[model samples]
Target chain A: MSAVWSITKKELVSYFTSPIAYIVIAIFILLSGFFFYSLVWWFNTQAMQMAQNPYYFQQININQMVFAPLFHNLSIILLLMLPVVSMRLFSEEKKMGTEELLFTSPVSVIQIILGKYLAALIVLLAMLVLSAIPTIFTFVHGNPEPVPYLLGYLGLFLLGAAFLALGIFWSALTENQIVSAVLTFGTLLLFWVLSWAAYSARGLWQDVLNYLSFFEHFDGMTKGILDTSDLVYYLSFAFFGLFLTHSVIQFRRWR
Target chain B: MIETEQLTKKYGDLVAIQNLSFRVEEGRIWGLLGPNAAGKTTTMRILTGYLPATSGRASVAGYDVFEQAEAVKQSIGYLPETVPLYPEMTVESYLGFVAEIKKVPAARKKAAVDRAVQIAGLQSVRKRLIRNISRGYKQRTGIAQALIHNPRVVILDEPTIGLDPAQIKEIRDLIKSLKGEHTVMLSTHILAEVKEVCDGVVIINEGKLMASGSLEELARSFSQNDGVYLKLDRADGEVLNLFRQLPGLKEAALDGAEIRLEWPWGQDLRTQVLKLCLDKRLEIREMRSLAMNIEELYLRIVSGGMEQ
Candidate 1:
């Protein structure tokens, strides 16, 4: 356990000691703030116009206007940014030859992979915390639903954990950080876009696909529903990716 | 002690090493001598548990390299040809990471890093980032990372390959200082390093062991006899011819005013040569026996007598 903690702390320190952590956080917050401000401003203007109307129009559906799109946009922003933050987790070490140093040590392959994965997870968590700043507007300026906000964050955390694990696996497969970043971005894009593809298609098979869609589950979190199945799905995704990463590193030892 | 029985490594159709069998007894520094691409790094990698052999068993410190690789890795500290370091990390932080991964206790980790830094003469640069340090300092950092855990066996591959003469001497001396407490297996093309620091030398060529023994034993086995050089005042062909025809002299060559005579066995031919020179009235400036140096003997064995 000390070995794992040692590697985790070392990786975490490396993340903060360089400009990468701050740069990634800056970009993530900047993009997320731009999207959040635009959405909330447009929705708040429409609500103001509805209040001034001579005829009532169901009070402009303010709850969905504030929480529903916030959840959706937050998920998309995280999907785009998490891959960039996680791309260097193992790829840089493999490129720099430090992978051999780690492999030759007495620590098992499990400890090394898990340590690096957890550190990247922590960085993603920090990004999640930063994303909450824009979400604070929903509570102060509009009708606040703390339940949905907290649950949506739980969903975002789980989703980002899953993506981070896959990103780590991709990073381990190559020595080039750009290749890892691009591949991870491509994989996340597929999952993000496929959720809508399944939602649009109308068939029995499509219904099954929509249920499997990442957004289908993430949408529940936006509504403040703690679905056990979505939790299982995201957890399994993270677990399997990490499992494959462990096996890949072990296979590299024999070769 | 370390032992490998027919350890082999094959990458696709290319065989890096085949049937490499050797042993290093406890408390000795063994040199793995080979030219480039002769499987020195491959052999070290197998022993370090970085790569598994295609067929055969390697046991280090009584643990099988394949079956008990974790134990083997615990016992061995390996410095590869290209030392992998985190450029962003300071020398102290890097060594601390190594000690941690190698399972040095937390209380002792600081002392372990300090000891390795001291041994590699890296105290002055301990706080500097690895990327900013000199190449020699980087190489020393590599050594320090490997030695941080105080493993029973230390393996270095081409430890002094890219260093300047001074750095090379410093690293060689560092390896020399590690003689008794640790069993070291260092591979290098510098034959003189083998003679200076190694207790036994293992020579490999074309992925096979050409010879394995101490320097003197190897020289004695391959060289027919120690050659004798005689610098004479007279440089006549007739004098060289007469010296070649003397009893117990197997061969003789003349270069300028010097004559080199080979004797197959240790016969007291110096008296005969002196008497012949006196009778011929030729002045002898210098006469000394020249034993074959380690380089020539190593080349002769590895190349099977072919030389440029």
Candidate 2:
């Protein structure tokens, strides 16, 4: 475990030494800020008459207006940002031959895999933390409930971890970082599009295919209902991706 | 110490190496001599735990490379055909990372890295990023990484492959200096480099062990009946008659002032030749045995194509 952490620490340092980390963080924050401002402007314009309807407005909760869109807009922000962090995790090392040094070291294979995974996870965590500015800014306009924000962040974290695992698995499959990035984006886009298809289906297939939707789990989180099944599903998804990555590593060594 | 028995590697239908066997004892530099695709690098990879043998066993530093790989890795430092290095890192940081991965004691890591830097003559480029350094410096950095942990055995695959003559001499001297402290096995196709540096030569050809012995011993075994060239102040016919008078002298050929003579094995023809020259009062300017050099011995072993 210490060996794994050591490698993770080294990878994090490597990220900072390169320009990829700052670029990913900058793009992520810029996109998140763009989404937050767009949602605020749209909601404020729609509820402009609430300024004069004092009686019903006082009775209505302002938290819904302030925090609801913040939670809703996070998915798209992450969809674009996560791949930037995860794309170069294994692909660049393979291209540079640094993977040989890592693999042949005294450290176990699990340590090397988990180290790369954790480095990308840390970068993601940093991105999520940066996106919290909008949630904090909601308190200036109106008293927003923190529960939904907390729940939304949890769902994003899990989703990001799952996406990162998929990215890492793809990174291990090839030596070209651009190919890894494009393929990861295509895969995540496929998943992102699946929820709409599942929702639009009219038959029993809709019920069956909806389980494959990442958005369905986000819906439960935004509603502040943390379903145990959703948590289990995301955890299993991440573990399955990691398992495939391990198999890829083992196959490289054996064959 | 190192030993291999019937070690083989095949890529598709092409065998990279096959049925190779040899033993390298401690306290000597063994040169693995073969052509570019002659499986020298493949054999080194198997010994260093980087690749597995297709059909045999290789043990290095008393650990079976396939079965006890971690142990083999711990005991050996391997420099691959391409010096696997991180070009983005400085020399100090690169060696530090090597020490960290090799698990040098925390208390001694800095000192070990320092010693390796000094030994490989990397002090000048210690603070420079590896990408900024020249190929010679990069090669030395590779050597420093291999020597960081001070493993019992060091295996270098074509360590001096791309260096200029001066850089090659520097690296050769460094390899020679590693003699008593570590058992070193280096591979090269340059015959002169092997003769100049290696205490023992192991020649392979077409993925098989052609011969293994000391340079002189291999030369003697492969080139048993050698000739002697005598340059003296004597006419061709007189020297031919003098050479024929000697009983064990097989044949004599004259080329201007030089007389070449071949003799049977274990014959003392030198004394007889000297006596004849003295009797004829021939002024002998030079009389020396023409033993086979490394190039001839390597060709004789490799092109002879014998399995032994």
Candidate 3:
């Protein structure tokens, strides 16, 4: 456990000391802030128009009108930004020959992988926390349901964790960070678009695609509904990606 | 402290090392001497638990390298051919991190780093970032990281590959100082380095062991006969003829003012030669045994001039 923490602390220090962490955080906050502003503006305009009619005004809630779109936009932003956060985790070690030091040390491979994975998760958490600033405005000016609002951020965190794990696996595949990032982005985009193909498919194929799509699992937590299956899906997806990373590292050692 | 038996590694059909075996006793410095692509790094990697051997066994500090890798790693320190360092970290922080992962206790981690810094002579640049330090300091930092945990065996692959002569001497001196407490196995292609620092040598070429012994032992084993040189004040054909009369003389030659004579191994003719020179009224200037240096021994072994 101390070995794992040592690796984690060193990785965290490296992440913050380099320009990659700041640049990634800056871009995520900027995009999420813009999305929040536009969504809230559109929500205000729709609320004004709906207030004249009682039936339409009943449908206007802050959770669905403003926060839901913002959460969805933040997920997209995370999908793009988290790969950059994870690209250097293993790629830089291999490129700089530091993997030799790491492997020759007494620490296990799982500890090293978990250390890097947790560092990326921490960066993802930081970005999520910073993006919550715009949501705080809704809490102060209007009464947004705190439960669903917090759940939406929970969904986003789980989604980002899954994306970061896959990114780490891709990073472990190659020494070139660019290639790792591109492969991660491409694989995540494929999983993101799986639901689009599900719409045209018939029978069990549609259900399988929907179940496999990240959008399906993340959609429920955006609202007030917290399904155990959705939580299990994200956690299992993360575990599978980490398992693949471990296999790759172990295979490389013997090869 | 370190031993390997028939350690072989094969990448598909290509052999990296085949039937390579050597032993490094505790508290002695051994040099792994070989040409480029001679499997020196591969052997060290296997011994350090960085890579697995295909069909052999290795042990470090009484732990099996493959079966008990973690235990072996805890007892060994390794520096690869490329000095692996985090360029963004200061030398002290880097050593601290190494000590942490190497499982130094929390209370002793700071003291471990301090001891390593003192031993590797890294105090001058301990606060400097690795990227900004000179190459010599960076190499020392690498050594410091390896020693931070105070492992029983230290394996350094080409530790002085790229340094100025002064820096090389400094690094060599540092390695020599590790003779009593640490069992060091350093790989180098420089023959002079082995001559200067190593107590014994393991020479490999083309992925096979050529020779392994002390410098004098290797020299004596490789040469067919023992030889001596005699410098005289006056030497002519008469002196050569006088030396040729000695029994059991394998060969004799006169060059310039010196006479070179060779006899079978284990033969001592020095007293006879001195008596002959004294009775002949010849003045002697300098006389010394002609033993092959490491350079000649390495060349002969690597070139396959002598049988393994």
Indicate which candidate wins on TM-score. Answer: 3
Which of the two, 2 or 3, has more lDDT? 3
For model 2, residues A1-255, the per-residue Cα lDDT tens digits are 766776777778778878888888888788778877877777677567675787756754444664556666777777776777788888888887777666656677777889889988999888889877765867776666778768888988999999999899999999998899888889988887887898789788887667777778778887678999899988998898889999997887656
Expressed as tens digits, the lDDT of each residue in A50-166 for candidate 3 is 999999989999999888888888888888888899899999999999999999998999999999898888888888898788779788899999988999999999999999899
**Once model 1 is optimally superposed onto the true structure by TM-score, how far is the C-alpha of residue A188 displaced, in angstroms?**
1.7
Q: Candidate 1: where is the Cα deviation over 4 Å?
A: A50-63, A137-143, A199-204, B224-290, B305-308
Model 2 stretches astray by more than 4 angstroms:
A46-48, A54-68, A200-208, B225-228, B233-289
Candidate order by decreasing TM-score:
3, 2, 1
Candidate 3: segments with Cα more than 4 A from true spot = B224-227, B237-257, B261-288, B305-307
Candidate 2: docking tier: acceptable
Q: Native-contact recovery for every candidate?
A: 0.82, 0.26, 0.82
Sliding window of 10 residues with minimal summed lDDT for model 2 chain B = B218-227
lDDT by residue (B1-308, candidate 1, tens digit) is: 88988888898889888888888887789999988999998899889888888998889999998899899999999898789888888999989888888989889988898899899999899999888999999999999887888989999989998899999999999999998999999999998898889998888876787777776676667667867789988776787788877978888888666888888655657788889989988888998766767787787878883322
lDDT minimum window of 10 residues, candidate 1 chain A? A54-63
Residue B65 alpha-carbon offset, candidate 3, angstroms: 0.7
